[model samples]
Target: MIQKRFGSADTTGRKLDVIGEYLSMYQKALGNTNFETLYIDGFAGSGEVPLAEHTDNLFDEDVRTVIAGSADRALNVDPPFARYIFIDKRRKCIDALKAKFKDSPNAERVNYSIGDANEHIQKICRAEQWRSQRGVILLDPFGSQVRWETIEAVAATKALDLWYLFPAGLGVFRQISNDGTVDQTHEASITRIYGTDAWKTAFFEPSKQTELFGEPVTKEKVVTPESAALFMIERLKRVFEGGVMDEMIPLGKHAYPSYYLLFAWGNASPKAKALANRLSKAAVKATDRKHGRIV
Candidate 1:
Protein backbone atom coordinates (compact mmCIF):
# COMPACT_ATOMS: atom_id res chain seq x y z
CA MET A 1 0.00 0.00 0.00
CA ILE A 2 2.55 2.56 -1.11
CA GLN A 3 1.05 6.00 -1.81
CA LYS A 4 2.37 9.06 -3.68
CA ARG A 5 1.06 12.26 -5.20
CA PHE A 6 1.39 13.30 -8.83
CA GLY A 7 -0.14 16.62 -9.92
CA SER A 8 -1.04 19.45 -7.54
CA ALA A 9 -4.59 18.22 -7.86
CA ASP A 10 -5.64 14.84 -6.54
CA THR A 11 -7.28 13.41 -9.68
CA THR A 12 -4.23 11.88 -11.31
CA GLY A 13 -2.71 10.87 -8.01
CA ARG A 14 -5.87 9.11 -6.89
CA LYS A 15 -6.15 7.22 -10.18
CA LEU A 16 -2.56 6.08 -9.90
CA ASP A 17 -3.15 4.99 -6.33
CA VAL A 18 -6.08 2.81 -7.34
CA ILE A 19 -4.09 1.27 -10.18
CA GLY A 20 -1.18 0.46 -7.86
CA GLU A 21 -3.52 -1.21 -5.40
CA TYR A 22 -5.17 -3.26 -8.12
CA LEU A 23 -1.83 -4.40 -9.51
CA SER A 24 -0.60 -5.40 -6.09
CA MET A 25 -3.75 -7.35 -5.31
CA TYR A 26 -3.64 -9.01 -8.72
CA GLN A 27 -0.05 -10.15 -8.27
CA LYS A 28 -0.67 -11.43 -4.78
CA ALA A 29 -3.66 -13.50 -5.84
CA LEU A 30 -1.74 -14.72 -8.87
CA GLY A 31 0.76 -16.35 -6.47
CA ASN A 32 4.19 -17.66 -7.46
CA THR A 33 4.41 -18.37 -11.15
CA ASN A 34 6.80 -18.01 -14.07
CA PHE A 35 4.72 -15.07 -15.39
CA GLU A 36 7.89 -13.21 -16.23
CA THR A 37 9.57 -11.38 -19.10
CA LEU A 38 8.40 -7.86 -19.87
CA TYR A 39 6.53 -5.19 -17.89
CA ILE A 40 6.29 -2.13 -20.10
CA ASP A 41 5.16 1.46 -19.57
CA GLY A 42 4.60 3.27 -22.81
CA PHE A 43 4.23 6.71 -21.24
CA ALA A 44 6.51 6.36 -18.26
CA GLY A 45 6.71 9.88 -16.81
CA SER A 46 9.67 11.48 -15.05
CA GLY A 47 8.99 9.12 -12.10
CA GLU A 48 8.02 12.15 -10.02
CA VAL A 49 6.07 15.40 -10.16
CA PRO A 50 6.82 18.62 -8.29
CA LEU A 51 3.89 19.84 -6.21
CA ALA A 52 3.31 22.11 -3.24
CA GLU A 53 1.65 21.30 0.08
CA HIS A 54 0.82 23.62 2.98
CA THR A 55 4.45 23.84 4.19
CA ASP A 56 5.66 23.59 0.62
CA ASN A 57 5.54 20.05 -0.83
CA LEU A 58 8.11 19.45 -3.57
CA PHE A 59 8.83 15.86 -4.57
CA ASP A 60 6.51 12.96 -5.48
CA GLU A 61 7.23 9.25 -5.45
CA ASP A 62 8.32 7.16 -8.42
CA VAL A 63 5.31 6.95 -10.79
CA ARG A 64 6.42 3.55 -12.04
CA THR A 65 5.17 1.78 -8.94
CA VAL A 66 3.45 -0.96 -10.96
CA ILE A 67 6.62 -1.76 -12.85
CA ALA A 68 8.55 -1.72 -9.60
CA GLY A 69 6.05 -4.14 -8.10
CA SER A 70 6.47 -6.50 -11.04
CA ALA A 71 10.23 -6.37 -10.58
CA ASP A 72 9.81 -7.24 -6.92
CA ARG A 73 7.59 -10.20 -7.77
CA ALA A 74 10.11 -11.40 -10.32
CA LEU A 75 12.86 -11.33 -7.73
CA ASN A 76 10.95 -13.22 -5.02
CA VAL A 77 9.31 -15.73 -7.35
CA ASP A 78 10.94 -18.94 -8.54
CA PRO A 79 12.38 -17.48 -11.74
CA PRO A 80 14.23 -14.33 -10.76
CA PHE A 81 14.64 -12.94 -14.26
CA ALA A 82 12.34 -10.25 -15.56
CA ARG A 83 12.76 -7.06 -17.58
CA TYR A 84 11.14 -3.62 -17.26
CA ILE A 85 10.96 -1.48 -20.38
CA PHE A 86 9.91 2.15 -19.97
CA ILE A 87 9.38 4.43 -22.95
CA ASP A 88 9.00 8.19 -22.89
CA LYS A 89 9.57 10.92 -25.44
CA ARG A 90 10.91 13.49 -23.03
CA ARG A 91 14.64 13.33 -22.39
CA LYS A 92 14.24 14.87 -18.96
CA CYS A 93 11.72 12.20 -17.94
CA ILE A 94 13.88 9.34 -19.17
CA ASP A 95 17.00 10.77 -17.51
CA ALA A 96 15.12 11.32 -14.28
CA LEU A 97 13.81 7.73 -14.26
CA LYS A 98 17.31 6.41 -14.99
CA ALA A 99 18.83 8.46 -12.17
CA LYS A 100 16.13 7.55 -9.66
CA PHE A 101 16.28 3.79 -10.27
CA LYS A 102 20.01 3.64 -10.98
CA ASP A 103 20.83 2.31 -7.50
CA SER A 104 17.72 0.20 -7.02
CA PRO A 105 18.07 -3.58 -6.52
CA ASN A 106 16.15 -4.21 -9.74
CA ALA A 107 17.96 -1.44 -11.61
CA GLU A 108 19.83 -3.80 -13.88
CA ARG A 109 16.59 -5.34 -15.07
CA VAL A 110 15.09 -2.00 -16.08
CA ASN A 111 15.58 -0.40 -19.48
CA TYR A 112 14.41 2.98 -20.76
CA SER A 113 13.78 3.81 -24.39
CA ILE A 114 13.40 7.43 -25.44
CA GLY A 115 10.94 8.11 -28.27
CA ASP A 116 7.27 8.32 -29.09
CA ALA A 117 5.70 5.14 -27.73
CA ASN A 118 3.75 4.62 -30.93
CA GLU A 119 6.90 4.61 -33.04
CA HIS A 120 8.85 2.03 -31.07
CA ILE A 121 6.09 -0.32 -29.90
CA GLN A 122 6.18 -2.29 -33.13
CA LYS A 123 9.95 -2.61 -33.12
CA ILE A 124 9.88 -3.89 -29.57
CA CYS A 125 7.18 -6.42 -30.44
CA ARG A 126 9.10 -7.63 -33.48
CA ALA A 127 12.12 -8.37 -31.31
CA GLU A 128 13.19 -12.03 -31.34
CA GLN A 129 12.70 -12.71 -27.66
CA TRP A 130 9.23 -11.19 -27.13
CA ARG A 131 7.84 -13.85 -29.43
CA SER A 132 8.03 -16.17 -26.45
CA GLN A 133 6.92 -15.89 -22.83
CA ARG A 134 4.05 -13.94 -21.32
CA GLY A 135 4.50 -10.16 -21.17
CA VAL A 136 2.19 -7.47 -19.81
CA ILE A 137 2.09 -4.03 -21.40
CA LEU A 138 0.66 -1.03 -19.58
CA LEU A 139 -0.28 1.55 -22.20
CA ASP A 140 -1.24 4.63 -20.20
CA PRO A 141 -0.93 7.74 -22.29
CA PHE A 142 -2.25 11.26 -21.68
CA GLY A 143 -5.07 10.96 -24.17
CA SER A 144 -4.93 9.77 -27.74
CA GLN A 145 -1.19 10.09 -27.98
CA VAL A 146 -1.11 6.33 -28.46
CA ARG A 147 -1.64 5.36 -32.08
CA TRP A 148 -3.58 2.46 -33.46
CA GLU A 149 -0.54 0.99 -35.14
CA THR A 150 1.20 0.76 -31.81
CA ILE A 151 -1.78 -0.98 -30.22
CA GLU A 152 -2.12 -3.25 -33.22
CA ALA A 153 1.55 -4.15 -33.03
CA VAL A 154 1.36 -4.85 -29.31
CA ALA A 155 -1.88 -6.82 -29.71
CA ALA A 156 -0.24 -8.75 -32.54
CA THR A 157 2.25 -10.08 -29.99
CA LYS A 158 -0.29 -12.81 -29.19
CA ALA A 159 1.39 -13.28 -25.82
CA LEU A 160 1.12 -9.71 -24.55
CA ASP A 161 -1.65 -8.59 -22.19
CA LEU A 162 -2.59 -4.96 -22.70
CA TRP A 163 -4.01 -2.58 -20.12
CA TYR A 164 -4.90 0.61 -21.93
CA LEU A 165 -6.35 4.06 -21.27
CA PHE A 166 -9.20 5.18 -23.45
CA PRO A 167 -10.06 8.82 -24.12
CA ALA A 168 -13.66 9.22 -22.95
CA GLY A 169 -14.02 12.84 -21.95
CA LEU A 170 -13.86 15.95 -24.10
CA GLY A 171 -10.91 14.63 -26.06
CA VAL A 172 -12.79 11.80 -27.78
CA PHE A 173 -16.46 12.76 -27.62
CA ARG A 174 -15.78 16.20 -29.10
CA GLN A 175 -15.10 14.53 -32.41
CA ILE A 176 -18.17 12.30 -32.23
CA SER A 177 -20.62 14.87 -33.57
CA ASN A 178 -18.73 15.61 -36.76
CA ASP A 179 -20.49 14.03 -39.72
CA GLY A 180 -18.24 11.87 -41.80
CA THR A 181 -15.88 14.81 -42.55
CA VAL A 182 -13.71 14.38 -39.46
CA ASP A 183 -9.94 14.43 -39.77
CA GLN A 184 -8.64 11.32 -41.44
CA THR A 185 -5.59 11.07 -39.23
CA HIS A 186 -7.58 10.47 -36.08
CA GLU A 187 -10.01 8.22 -37.86
CA ALA A 188 -7.18 6.17 -39.27
CA SER A 189 -5.62 5.79 -35.85
CA ILE A 190 -8.94 4.65 -34.37
CA THR A 191 -9.45 2.20 -37.22
CA ARG A 192 -6.08 0.63 -36.76
CA ILE A 193 -6.57 0.20 -33.03
CA TYR A 194 -10.08 -1.15 -33.46
CA GLY A 195 -8.99 -3.38 -36.40
CA THR A 196 -12.08 -2.37 -38.36
CA ASP A 197 -13.79 0.56 -40.04
CA ALA A 198 -17.10 -0.09 -38.27
CA TRP A 199 -16.71 2.95 -36.03
CA LYS A 200 -17.08 5.14 -39.06
CA THR A 201 -20.52 3.66 -39.51
CA ALA A 202 -21.27 4.57 -35.93
CA PHE A 203 -20.53 8.19 -36.66
CA PHE A 204 -23.20 8.30 -39.37
CA GLU A 205 -25.82 6.43 -37.40
CA PRO A 206 -28.32 8.60 -35.55
CA SER A 207 -28.23 8.94 -31.80
CA LYS A 208 -30.51 6.62 -29.86
CA GLN A 209 -31.45 5.57 -26.32
CA THR A 210 -29.95 2.30 -25.25
CA GLU A 211 -29.64 0.13 -22.17
CA LEU A 212 -26.10 -0.33 -20.94
CA PHE A 213 -25.47 -2.83 -18.13
CA GLY A 214 -29.27 -2.86 -17.75
CA GLU A 215 -29.44 0.88 -17.18
CA PRO A 216 -31.14 3.26 -19.60
CA VAL A 217 -28.73 5.90 -20.91
CA THR A 218 -28.80 8.40 -23.69
CA LYS A 219 -26.13 10.27 -25.61
CA GLU A 220 -25.26 11.11 -29.21
CA LYS A 221 -26.44 7.51 -29.74
CA VAL A 222 -24.09 6.73 -32.60
CA VAL A 223 -20.78 5.18 -31.54
CA THR A 224 -21.15 5.50 -27.81
CA PRO A 225 -17.85 5.90 -26.01
CA GLU A 226 -18.52 2.67 -24.19
CA SER A 227 -19.05 0.90 -27.48
CA ALA A 228 -15.85 2.37 -28.87
CA ALA A 229 -13.97 1.17 -25.85
CA LEU A 230 -15.50 -2.28 -26.09
CA PHE A 231 -14.78 -2.35 -29.81
CA MET A 232 -11.08 -1.91 -29.22
CA ILE A 233 -11.17 -4.42 -26.38
CA GLU A 234 -12.86 -7.04 -28.55
CA ARG A 235 -10.29 -6.45 -31.29
CA LEU A 236 -7.53 -7.15 -28.81
CA LYS A 237 -9.39 -10.25 -27.71
CA ARG A 238 -9.59 -11.49 -31.29
CA VAL A 239 -5.93 -10.69 -31.90
CA PHE A 240 -5.01 -12.68 -28.84
CA GLU A 241 -7.21 -15.70 -29.38
CA GLY A 242 -6.39 -16.92 -25.93
CA GLY A 243 -7.54 -13.66 -24.36
CA VAL A 244 -10.87 -11.94 -23.72
CA MET A 245 -12.08 -8.37 -23.10
CA ASP A 246 -13.64 -8.83 -19.69
CA GLU A 247 -15.61 -5.64 -18.94
CA MET A 248 -15.35 -1.89 -18.60
CA ILE A 249 -13.99 -0.72 -15.26
CA PRO A 250 -16.55 2.05 -14.80
CA LEU A 251 -14.70 5.00 -13.30
CA GLY A 252 -18.18 6.35 -12.45
CA LYS A 253 -19.82 9.44 -13.80
CA HIS A 254 -18.47 12.79 -12.64
CA ALA A 255 -19.84 16.28 -13.17
CA TYR A 256 -16.39 17.78 -13.37
CA PRO A 257 -13.71 16.79 -15.85
CA SER A 258 -11.25 13.97 -16.33
CA TYR A 259 -8.87 13.26 -19.18
CA TYR A 260 -9.18 9.57 -19.97
CA LEU A 261 -10.97 6.26 -19.46
CA LEU A 262 -9.21 3.44 -17.61
CA PHE A 263 -9.54 -0.18 -18.75
CA ALA A 264 -7.65 -3.48 -18.46
CA TRP A 265 -7.27 -6.51 -20.74
CA GLY A 266 -5.48 -9.84 -20.47
CA ASN A 267 -5.94 -13.59 -20.89
CA ALA A 268 -9.52 -14.08 -19.66
CA SER A 269 -8.47 -16.33 -16.82
CA PRO A 270 -10.45 -16.52 -13.59
CA LYS A 271 -7.74 -14.54 -11.83
CA ALA A 272 -7.76 -11.84 -14.48
CA LYS A 273 -11.56 -11.61 -14.37
CA ALA A 274 -11.56 -11.35 -10.60
CA LEU A 275 -8.91 -8.66 -10.74
CA ALA A 276 -10.87 -6.71 -13.32
CA ASN A 277 -14.06 -6.96 -11.29
CA ARG A 278 -12.22 -5.70 -8.25
CA LEU A 279 -10.80 -2.81 -10.20
CA SER A 280 -14.21 -1.97 -11.61
CA LYS A 281 -15.78 -1.89 -8.17
CA ALA A 282 -12.97 0.26 -6.83
CA ALA A 283 -13.32 2.65 -9.73
CA VAL A 284 -17.07 2.88 -9.19
CA LYS A 285 -16.58 3.62 -5.54
CA ALA A 286 -13.98 6.27 -6.28
CA THR A 287 -16.17 7.83 -8.89
CA ASP A 288 -19.07 7.84 -6.48
CA ARG A 289 -16.95 9.63 -3.93
CA LYS A 290 -15.83 12.22 -6.44
CA HIS A 291 -19.36 12.90 -7.63
CA GLY A 292 -21.02 12.72 -4.23
CA ARG A 293 -23.09 9.79 -5.43
CA ILE A 294 -24.07 6.75 -3.41
CA VAL A 295 -21.67 3.86 -3.85
Candidate 2:
Protein backbone atom coordinates (compact mmCIF):
# COMPACT_ATOMS: atom_id res chain seq x y z
CA MET A 1 0.00 0.00 0.00
CA ILE A 2 1.23 3.50 -0.80
CA GLN A 3 1.73 5.62 2.30
CA LYS A 4 0.66 9.22 2.53
CA ARG A 5 3.48 11.77 2.22
CA PHE A 6 3.66 14.95 4.27
CA GLY A 7 6.17 17.71 4.70
CA SER A 8 8.01 18.69 7.86
CA ALA A 9 8.60 15.21 9.13
CA ASP A 10 10.11 16.49 12.38
CA THR A 11 7.13 18.66 13.22
CA THR A 12 4.51 16.10 12.19
CA GLY A 13 6.28 13.34 14.04
CA ARG A 14 6.41 15.47 17.16
CA LYS A 15 2.68 16.08 16.95
CA LEU A 16 1.83 12.40 16.67
CA ASP A 17 4.24 11.60 19.47
CA VAL A 18 2.59 14.05 21.83
CA ILE A 19 -0.80 12.70 20.83
CA GLY A 20 0.38 9.13 21.30
CA GLU A 21 1.55 9.91 24.81
CA TYR A 22 -1.79 11.42 25.78
CA LEU A 23 -3.75 8.59 24.22
CA SER A 24 -1.99 6.11 26.44
CA MET A 25 -2.54 8.28 29.48
CA TYR A 26 -6.18 8.86 28.58
CA GLN A 27 -6.97 5.16 28.29
CA LYS A 28 -5.09 4.21 31.46
CA ALA A 29 -6.90 6.88 33.47
CA LEU A 30 -10.43 6.04 32.27
CA GLY A 31 -10.12 2.46 31.06
CA ASN A 32 -11.95 1.00 34.03
CA THR A 33 -14.45 3.81 34.31
CA ASN A 34 -18.10 3.50 33.34
CA PHE A 35 -17.71 5.86 30.42
CA GLU A 36 -17.48 4.29 26.97
CA THR A 37 -14.22 5.68 25.67
CA LEU A 38 -13.83 6.65 22.04
CA TYR A 39 -11.13 8.03 19.77
CA ILE A 40 -12.01 10.27 16.82
CA ASP A 41 -9.52 11.42 14.20
CA GLY A 42 -10.94 14.27 12.19
CA PHE A 43 -8.24 14.35 9.51
CA ALA A 44 -7.21 10.71 9.60
CA GLY A 45 -4.84 10.11 6.75
CA SER A 46 -3.81 6.76 5.40
CA GLY A 47 -3.10 4.46 8.37
CA GLU A 48 0.56 5.38 8.24
CA VAL A 49 2.67 8.26 7.01
CA PRO A 50 5.84 8.00 4.90
CA LEU A 51 8.45 10.36 6.25
CA ALA A 52 11.71 11.08 4.49
CA GLU A 53 14.69 10.59 6.74
CA HIS A 54 18.26 11.53 6.13
CA THR A 55 20.32 8.71 4.64
CA ASP A 56 23.95 8.18 3.86
CA ASN A 57 23.16 6.35 0.64
CA LEU A 58 25.30 7.70 -2.13
CA PHE A 59 22.70 6.84 -4.75
CA ASP A 60 19.47 7.85 -2.98
CA GLU A 61 18.98 11.28 -1.39
CA ASP A 62 16.87 10.11 1.56
CA VAL A 63 15.12 7.05 2.94
CA ARG A 64 11.37 6.80 3.28
CA THR A 65 10.24 5.50 6.68
CA VAL A 66 6.77 4.44 7.65
CA ILE A 67 5.31 5.46 11.01
CA ALA A 68 1.91 5.02 12.60
CA GLY A 69 -0.43 7.96 12.15
CA SER A 70 -2.96 9.14 14.73
CA ALA A 71 -5.56 6.53 13.82
CA ASP A 72 -3.05 3.75 14.20
CA ARG A 73 -1.74 5.22 17.42
CA ALA A 74 -5.22 5.39 18.93
CA LEU A 75 -5.92 1.81 17.91
CA ASN A 76 -2.77 0.61 19.65
CA VAL A 77 -3.31 2.47 22.92
CA ASP A 78 -2.66 0.05 25.82
CA PRO A 79 -6.23 -0.08 27.14
CA PRO A 80 -7.71 0.48 23.73
CA PHE A 81 -10.56 2.90 23.16
CA ALA A 82 -14.02 1.31 23.04
CA ARG A 83 -14.67 2.76 19.61
CA TYR A 84 -12.76 4.58 16.89
CA ILE A 85 -14.04 6.96 14.23
CA PHE A 86 -11.71 8.09 11.47
CA ILE A 87 -12.92 10.78 9.08
CA ASP A 88 -11.30 12.19 5.97
CA LYS A 89 -12.74 14.20 3.15
CA ARG A 90 -10.78 12.24 0.58
CA ARG A 91 -12.34 8.95 -0.38
CA LYS A 92 -8.95 7.51 -1.21
CA CYS A 93 -7.74 8.06 2.32
CA ILE A 94 -10.80 6.43 3.86
CA ASP A 95 -10.49 3.55 1.45
CA ALA A 96 -6.89 3.08 2.41
CA LEU A 97 -7.78 3.00 6.09
CA LYS A 98 -10.55 0.49 5.48
CA ALA A 99 -8.18 -1.75 3.58
CA LYS A 100 -5.59 -1.50 6.32
CA PHE A 101 -7.98 -2.57 9.07
CA LYS A 102 -10.37 -4.82 7.15
CA ASP A 103 -9.07 -8.01 8.74
CA SER A 104 -8.27 -6.81 12.24
CA PRO A 105 -9.81 -8.61 15.23
CA ASN A 106 -11.43 -5.38 16.46
CA ALA A 107 -12.17 -4.08 12.99
CA GLU A 108 -15.86 -3.80 13.80
CA ARG A 109 -15.04 -1.15 16.38
CA VAL A 110 -13.53 1.19 13.83
CA ASN A 111 -15.75 3.38 11.68
CA TYR A 112 -14.49 5.15 8.59
CA SER A 113 -16.23 8.13 7.01
CA ILE A 114 -15.51 9.75 3.72
CA GLY A 115 -16.68 13.35 3.64
CA ASP A 116 -16.17 16.73 5.23
CA ALA A 117 -14.73 16.16 8.74
CA ASN A 118 -16.44 19.23 10.18
CA GLU A 119 -19.91 18.00 9.20
CA HIS A 120 -19.35 14.43 10.30
CA ILE A 121 -17.75 15.43 13.62
CA GLN A 122 -20.50 17.90 14.39
CA LYS A 123 -23.06 15.18 13.83
CA ILE A 124 -21.16 12.84 16.15
CA CYS A 125 -20.88 15.49 18.84
CA ARG A 126 -24.60 16.27 18.72
CA ALA A 127 -25.69 12.67 19.05
CA GLU A 128 -27.51 11.92 22.32
CA GLN A 129 -25.28 8.98 23.18
CA TRP A 130 -22.47 11.32 24.22
CA ARG A 131 -23.92 11.68 27.74
CA SER A 132 -22.70 8.19 28.67
CA GLN A 133 -19.59 8.32 26.51
CA ARG A 134 -16.23 10.05 26.87
CA GLY A 135 -13.56 10.39 24.22
CA VAL A 136 -10.81 12.43 22.64
CA ILE A 137 -11.31 14.10 19.29
CA LEU A 138 -8.26 15.19 17.35
CA LEU A 139 -8.90 18.13 15.03
CA ASP A 140 -5.66 18.21 13.07
CA PRO A 141 -6.87 20.01 9.99
CA PHE A 142 -4.54 20.91 7.13
CA GLY A 143 -5.42 24.56 7.47
CA SER A 144 -8.52 26.32 8.80
CA GLN A 145 -10.81 23.54 7.70
CA VAL A 146 -12.34 23.17 11.15
CA ARG A 147 -15.16 25.73 11.42
CA TRP A 148 -16.01 27.44 14.70
CA GLU A 149 -19.51 25.96 14.82
CA THR A 150 -18.01 22.48 14.77
CA ILE A 151 -15.85 23.40 17.76
CA GLU A 152 -18.93 24.66 19.58
CA ALA A 153 -20.65 21.37 18.86
CA VAL A 154 -17.74 19.49 20.42
CA ALA A 155 -17.76 21.85 23.38
CA ALA A 156 -21.44 21.16 23.93
CA THR A 157 -20.80 17.44 24.16
CA LYS A 158 -19.20 17.93 27.58
CA ALA A 159 -17.64 14.51 27.26
CA LEU A 160 -15.04 14.53 24.53
CA ASP A 161 -11.61 16.09 25.05
CA LEU A 162 -10.23 18.20 22.22
CA TRP A 163 -6.77 18.29 20.60
CA TYR A 164 -7.11 21.03 18.03
CA LEU A 165 -4.21 22.15 15.88
CA PHE A 166 -5.08 25.68 14.97
CA PRO A 167 -3.51 27.06 11.80
CA ALA A 168 -2.19 30.20 13.41
CA GLY A 169 0.30 31.33 10.79
CA LEU A 170 -0.81 29.69 7.58
CA GLY A 171 -4.52 30.35 8.05
CA VAL A 172 -5.09 33.38 10.28
CA PHE A 173 -2.02 35.59 10.40
CA ARG A 174 -1.23 35.13 6.71
CA GLN A 175 -4.65 36.34 5.72
CA ILE A 176 -4.44 39.52 7.77
CA SER A 177 -2.01 41.93 6.13
CA ASN A 178 0.23 44.18 8.19
CA ASP A 179 -1.89 47.11 6.99
CA GLY A 180 -4.92 45.21 8.41
CA THR A 181 -6.48 44.73 5.00
CA VAL A 182 -8.76 41.71 4.81
CA ASP A 183 -10.70 40.91 1.66
CA GLN A 184 -14.34 39.90 1.65
CA THR A 185 -13.70 36.18 1.32
CA HIS A 186 -10.86 36.15 3.85
CA GLU A 187 -12.96 38.16 6.28
CA ALA A 188 -15.80 35.68 6.05
CA SER A 189 -13.48 32.73 6.43
CA ILE A 190 -11.78 34.22 9.48
CA THR A 191 -15.10 35.17 11.02
CA ARG A 192 -16.44 31.69 10.46
CA ILE A 193 -13.40 30.10 12.09
CA TYR A 194 -13.38 32.51 15.04
CA GLY A 195 -17.19 32.46 15.44
CA THR A 196 -17.13 36.22 15.80
CA ASP A 197 -15.83 39.42 14.21
CA ALA A 198 -14.10 40.49 17.40
CA TRP A 199 -10.77 39.22 16.06
CA LYS A 200 -10.64 42.39 13.97
CA THR A 201 -10.34 44.66 16.95
CA ALA A 202 -8.49 42.09 19.03
CA PHE A 203 -5.65 41.75 16.52
CA PHE A 204 -5.63 45.21 15.06
CA GLU A 205 -5.57 48.79 16.30
CA PRO A 206 -6.24 52.21 14.86
CA SER A 207 -3.13 53.80 13.31
CA LYS A 208 -2.22 57.12 14.92
CA GLN A 209 -1.61 58.62 11.50
CA THR A 210 -5.00 57.53 10.21
CA GLU A 211 -6.85 59.36 13.05
CA LEU A 212 -6.22 62.67 11.27
CA PHE A 213 -8.24 61.51 8.24
CA GLY A 214 -10.90 59.85 10.50
CA GLU A 215 -13.18 58.97 7.57
CA PRO A 216 -11.20 55.86 6.55
CA VAL A 217 -9.00 55.38 9.54
CA THR A 218 -6.58 52.63 8.57
CA LYS A 219 -6.19 49.83 11.03
CA GLU A 220 -2.74 48.46 11.84
CA LYS A 221 -2.43 44.79 12.62
CA VAL A 222 -0.97 44.38 16.09
CA VAL A 223 -0.76 40.62 16.35
CA THR A 224 2.32 38.52 15.80
CA PRO A 225 1.87 34.87 14.83
CA GLU A 226 2.62 33.80 18.40
CA SER A 227 0.19 36.31 19.89
CA ALA A 228 -2.48 35.27 17.41
CA ALA A 229 -2.12 31.66 18.55
CA LEU A 230 -2.41 32.73 22.20
CA PHE A 231 -5.55 34.66 21.33
CA MET A 232 -7.11 31.52 19.89
CA ILE A 233 -6.40 29.59 23.08
CA GLU A 234 -8.02 32.37 25.13
CA ARG A 235 -11.08 32.29 22.89
CA LEU A 236 -11.33 28.54 23.36
CA LYS A 237 -11.16 28.85 27.14
CA ARG A 238 -14.35 30.90 27.07
CA VAL A 239 -16.35 28.07 25.52
CA PHE A 240 -14.92 24.99 27.19
CA GLU A 241 -16.40 24.67 30.66
CA GLY A 242 -13.84 22.05 31.58
CA GLY A 243 -11.03 24.45 30.71
CA VAL A 244 -8.30 24.90 28.10
CA MET A 245 -4.61 24.03 28.48
CA ASP A 246 -2.59 27.19 28.99
CA GLU A 247 0.60 26.02 27.26
CA MET A 248 -0.21 25.45 23.61
CA ILE A 249 2.58 23.81 21.61
CA PRO A 250 3.62 25.84 18.59
CA LEU A 251 4.49 23.50 15.68
CA GLY A 252 6.27 24.48 12.52
CA LYS A 253 9.28 23.62 10.40
CA HIS A 254 12.54 25.53 10.75
CA ALA A 255 11.47 27.47 13.82
CA TYR A 256 8.69 29.36 12.04
CA PRO A 257 5.24 29.71 13.50
CA SER A 258 2.73 27.57 11.66
CA TYR A 259 0.32 25.61 13.83
CA TYR A 260 -0.53 25.63 17.53
CA LEU A 261 -1.83 22.52 19.25
CA LEU A 262 -4.45 23.47 21.82
CA PHE A 263 -6.01 21.05 24.27
CA ALA A 264 -9.40 21.50 25.94
CA TRP A 265 -11.45 19.20 28.11
CA GLY A 266 -15.19 18.97 27.56
CA ASN A 267 -16.04 17.22 30.80
CA ALA A 268 -17.15 19.74 33.40
CA SER A 269 -15.89 17.77 36.38
CA PRO A 270 -13.02 19.56 38.07
CA LYS A 271 -11.01 16.39 38.53
CA ALA A 272 -11.44 15.33 34.94
CA LYS A 273 -10.47 18.79 33.74
CA ALA A 274 -7.37 18.85 35.90
CA LEU A 275 -6.27 15.37 34.89
CA ALA A 276 -6.82 16.17 31.25
CA ASN A 277 -4.66 19.26 31.48
CA ARG A 278 -1.96 17.47 33.41
CA LEU A 279 -1.61 14.63 30.93
CA SER A 280 -1.84 16.80 27.83
CA LYS A 281 0.66 19.31 29.19
CA ALA A 282 3.12 16.58 30.09
CA ALA A 283 2.80 15.09 26.62
CA VAL A 284 3.54 18.44 25.03
CA LYS A 285 6.49 19.04 27.28
CA ALA A 286 7.84 15.55 26.66
CA THR A 287 7.74 16.05 22.92
CA ASP A 288 9.43 19.41 23.27
CA ARG A 289 12.22 18.00 25.42
CA LYS A 290 12.79 15.12 23.04
CA HIS A 291 12.77 17.17 19.85
CA GLY A 292 13.62 20.61 21.20
CA ARG A 293 11.12 23.46 20.95
CA ILE A 294 10.03 24.49 17.48
CA VAL A 295 10.97 28.08 18.29
What TM-score would each prediction reach against the true structure? 0.66, 0.91
**Candidate 2, which segments miss by more than 4 Å at Cα?**
1-5, 52-62, 208-217, 293-295
lDDT of 1 by residue, 175-196 (tens): 5543334577666655655557
Judged by TM-score, which candidate is best?
A: 2
Worst 10 residues of 1 by lDDT: 62-71
Identify the runs in model 1 with alpha carbons over 4 angstroms from their true place: 1-10, 26-32, 49-81, 128-132, 178-181, 206-221, 250-295
lDDT of candidate 2 over 128-213, digit per residue (tens)? 49877989999988788989999999999999899998989888899987778888888898888888888888998887666533
Question: Model 1's lDDT to the true fold?
Answer: 0.56
lDDT per model vs. reference: 0.56, 0.85
Error of 1 at 28 (Å): 3.7
